[model samples]
Target: MPQSHPFARVSILCKTYDPESGFNESHAEVIELHDDQPEAVDAVLKYIYTFEYDNIVRTGKDKTRPQFHLRVYRVAHKYQIPKLQHKACTGLDRACRKITLQTSGSKNGSSSEELFELIKLITEHKQYDHSFNTTSIYLVQRYLSPLMRLKTFNE
Candidate 1:
């Protein structure tokens, strides 16, 4: 029987095994990770072994950086990995800053349609509520403040 792999030893996945018994002698266990995103899992695994992950900040029309970070954060939280959670949160904050800058600096700013999509994406994820992080709340406030001012004056 083969020994447990090094990567599995440090992860929460290993907690299921009894320390007194060798993992190789135990019955085969199948763990299904249906709720986790493959990309997010890959990123967390890479970070676990290498202490590094791909930057979430990139210029593109996709705007999936925040989504990726959110997914990673969820995975980390589920797996009880504090270090990964911290990294994911930091990445999320950074991505939010980049997104804010991109939208605010645009010649016409983000269109109402784009803003609506952004709001929908954030609100759809429970992890993005006001208590999750200040950056997310700040982003929403920043975008809404201008609209609120315009509406107040127009009324």
Candidate 2:
């Protein structure tokens, strides 16, 4: 791996690679993460190893599916994986588009619960100002704007 790689850049990974710590001596090949969601971790690993990920567009009844890309974006940001971050952004954009399409023709647009979840995800990414700002703007422009207009018209 290159010295500039995200794995090398992350302090925790750097510590694990330290020869003096004896961590690499005993488990040189294994890196164990205890407190992360398996799906998010898998997405990061997939991007790191393969430079790509499948199923960026999830299709199912799972209410939490829309947040998956956001989770990936958060993980990538935490790990300093720029490429993965960009990919996650693309995935997130796609997810937002999908959500917009799915809910567009409905009387009130998306369910309150679903919108709440998306809002929560957006809030979580607020520290990542660039991504958060762009995403929030996109959501407002694409989804909330039309919904608001509909409500205004109804009123």
Candidate 3:
């Protein structure tokens, strides 16, 4: 880790672990992400090292899946990487906007219930977080009208 890297400022990595003390010897050098998805972790690492991460979440037709970016945002927030968090948030917002625009918020888009799932996902991860709450608001207030109008809008 270089001196200028934002990851260098993360508290877990900044700990002065003593080589001789061997504290938590089994995993002293590892930063476990038990709750994070592998792709999100990969994206965070890629951003940490290279500062670019658009390709990891793209599906067919250049349409980025919002769930992937949401995971990236969660991991970035957990690791205190504000830049990556913001970037992922922007990606998610754009993805939602793109989907809604492409389907004109009707017919084809109503089947894509991931907008509601995204809100549920954020709530599961962090109920008290401003970022998560704001994202939920954006999903519900801004982009959920069409889906909400549908009769199958359960959960």
Best model number under lDDT: 3
Whose TM-score is higher: candidate 1's or candidate 3's? 3
lDDT string, candidate 2, 1-155, tens digits: 74466555656666756777786544557666665666788778766766655543342344235578777777787778877777777767666666643354766346644664576678678777476667767766666644465543234
Q: Which pairs, if any, clash in model 1?
A: none
* Segments in model 3 whose C-alpha atoms lie over 4 Å from true places: 1-4, 10-18, 25-32, 55-63, 101-112, 123-135, 141-146, 149-155
RMSD of every candidate to native, in Å, equals 7.8, 6.0, 5.1
Q: Write the per-residue lDDT of candidate 3 for residues 1-155, one digit (tens) a residue.
A: 53345767544554635464455643466856589998788888778877776655553343277777778888887778877887887787677666553375466553445566666776675553566666667667776666576555543
- lDDT tens per residue, model 1, 1-155: 66444365465455555555566424557555789988777777777776665443232333246677778878777766666666777766666666543355676345544554554555555553343447646676767654454443235
Off by over 4 Å in 2: 1-3, 6-19, 22-34, 54-64, 101-110, 145-155
Q: 1 or 3: which has the higher lDDT?
A: 3
- Model 1, stretches more than 4 Å misplaced? 1-12, 15-31, 54-64, 100-131, 145-155
Clash pairs, model 3 backbone:
none
Q: Report the poorest 10 consecutive residues by lDDT, candidate 1.
A: 55-64
